[model samples]
Target: MSDIIRIQNLQKAYPGFALEGVTFSVPRGAVVGFIGENGAGKTTAIKCILGLVRPSGGGVEVFGKDAALLTAEERGRIGAVLGENCLPENLTAGQLDRVMRHIFPHWESETFASFLGRFSLPQGKKVADFSRGMHQKLALAVALSHGADVLVLDEPTAGLDPVARDEILELLYDFMQEERRSVLISSHIVTDLEKLCDYIAFIHNGKLLFFEEKDALYERYAVVHAPVEALQGLKDAVVAARRGEFGASALVRRDKLPAGTSAERAGIEEIMLYFIKGERI
Candidate 1:
């Protein structure tokens, strides 16, 4: 598959937090999970990709064209739901749809209406009266209604219920079935991405910790829980670790694992924690 989104050497420097040397490619039809903690530069990198925030260095390409140089015509292919992505408190759900239809020439009112129907959103009810879940759904409806090939979402499921989160995940899966559609979603909800994404990239302290296929990430990383004394010898193998009085635990590459010892399969949560801990032998 060809690359649908390419972020090469992207850097956004700040007084305290900076995105340094960020690079990755999301191939068409691939769903990439942009995983990071709060203040980990996920939002900063996303803003640069959307051309909403200017970058200090590097380039962003969307659908084979530079995002920075993209004309409005070239940009319509991407749908974004960033931050709160809220509708005006005074605008009703139907009014929100109308506004979107005008803003996006390719807007699919029928499909958007169907999504509203599916989500059971009340028409003509202003956003001021809506619950947090309802507001989130409204933002999603706006993002998906335009028939965009690439969806760039940041923290879309931050405070959603399990059911609501599942619905969003299902929608993402359904969107990818079109074959030309792809998504770059950033979230701290690791399990959600583990369920929906084809690839995963981890960012921590404004630096890229790792980028790889989700399956490979699971395959190559291991969590070795051993006695405190045994942990010392294993430090040479740890990518990140924590040691104290009780005992020591570490995340190590599979190859560095001892021949006699077996490590537990690492989950996305464990991987994220280890990477952020920045423990190196």
Candidate 2:
């Protein structure tokens, strides 16, 4: 499948932090989860993709067009929800709808109205009166109202309760029922991504650590429980390990594991924690 979004060696530098050689792609008809800890450059990489932050080096492309060069019409095909709401607090949902109709050439009032009703958002109530979850739902409704082929969401589900998060995820799943639709969602909530994503891209300290199909990532790594001595000899295979009084548990490459050693399937959260917090053997 062709990529809807492609980021190649994208770089950005601040006074103290830098996004270093990031690269990943969101393929058509799939949800690609962008996962990392806070300060891992997930947001920066996304901003670069949206042309919000100027990259110091490298490139980003959306819909086969360079992101920086996308025309207004090309940009209309993409919808984005950043961390901030960016909507006027004094404006009611009804007023926002009117403004959006003017902004997006393909805006659908019927679709927006349906989403507001489905999400239980109040059209006449000012945005300032809505709760965080309500604001998020409104933002999502806005993003979906326009005829967008791709969604770029940064921390879209953050600060939401389980029920609300699930509702939002269900909306995304429904959006992808149209085979050409795609999404690039960045969040620290690995479990949510685990449920909705076909591919996972991990970033650490502003660098792209790995990007692979979710199933392949699980297949490539395993968590093994063995003696510390056994783990010591397999340093090359061990990504991270924890030692205790009884034994050692390590995240290791499946193929490199010793014969007869049993390894359990590793979840995305477990893998991420080990890679971020555990000691490398």
Candidate 3:
């Protein structure tokens, strides 16, 4: 697959957490979810990619060209919606629209206006008067209006109601139908990603845990239940622990479970919970 964004041995240092040797490639036209717990370096990794924070080591390439060296013209192709609203609350939605339209050379005025109707954002109201969810939709509208090739979103679904979240995810799914557009979404909403992502990359404790295809995640990953005595000798399962009064259960790869063992298919939430609540990192 052609890579839209490639990170090679990426490293970033923090006072407490350090992103160490992280590497991943976001294939062109695919929606890849960057999953991790709070403070697990998801935003830090994204900031590095967006140049909001400089990496202490390694490289970032956008469209096969070094991101750090990209001119403003080259950088304009990438659009982002950060975790927080950076909009001027005093500005009316119309004013905000004008600002964004001016900033993005390819800005689609009709598309942006249509999204206002689609999102039901009031044009006359100041952003400060709008609820949290409204602002998020507005930010998304701005990102989509730019006619960007890549959408790099950070926690874009955090505040939306379930219906709105579904709508936004559906929009992403449709957006990629053009075969030249792509998205790199970092969200704690794993369930949403499970429904929308073509690829998944799990990051935790400032490190990468796993990177694989969505279908493989469901097919190869499994949750196994077994007795403590049985788990004691098990070497294939990374997750195994005694729980309650029943002994032990485990999260294992389907192919690696012991003889006679039958494990259930694991979903994204189950896989994430196994990583966080179980014995694994």
* Highest-lDDT candidate: 2
Lowest lDDT block of 10, candidate 3:
235-244
lDDT of each residue in 119-227, candidate 2, tens digit only: 8999999999999899998999999999999999999999899998999899999999999999999988899999999999999999998999999989999998888
TM-score of each: 0.95, 0.96, 0.94
Instruction: Put down candidate 3 lDDT per residue, 162-268, tens digits, no spaces.
Output: 98788788778767888998899999889999888999989989888888889988878787677766665565664534354766677777777677777788888
Q: Give candidate 3's error at residue 21 in angstroms.
A: 0.8
TM-score of predicted structure 2:
0.96
Q: Is candidate 2 or candidate 3 better by lDDT?
A: 2
RMSD from true fold, candidate 1: 1.5
lDDT of 1 by residue, 19-132 (tens): 999999788999999998899999999999899989889899988888888877667788888867456889998888788777887888888889889999888898889877
lDDT of 1: 0.86
The collision pairs in model 2 are none
Q: What stretches of model 2 exceed 4 Å from their correct place? A: 244-247
TM-score of 1: 0.95
**Model 2 whole-model lDDT (C-alpha atoms):** 0.92
**Which model scores highest in TM-score?**
2
Q: Which residue runs of candidate 3 sit more than 4 Å off their true CA positions?
A: 238-242
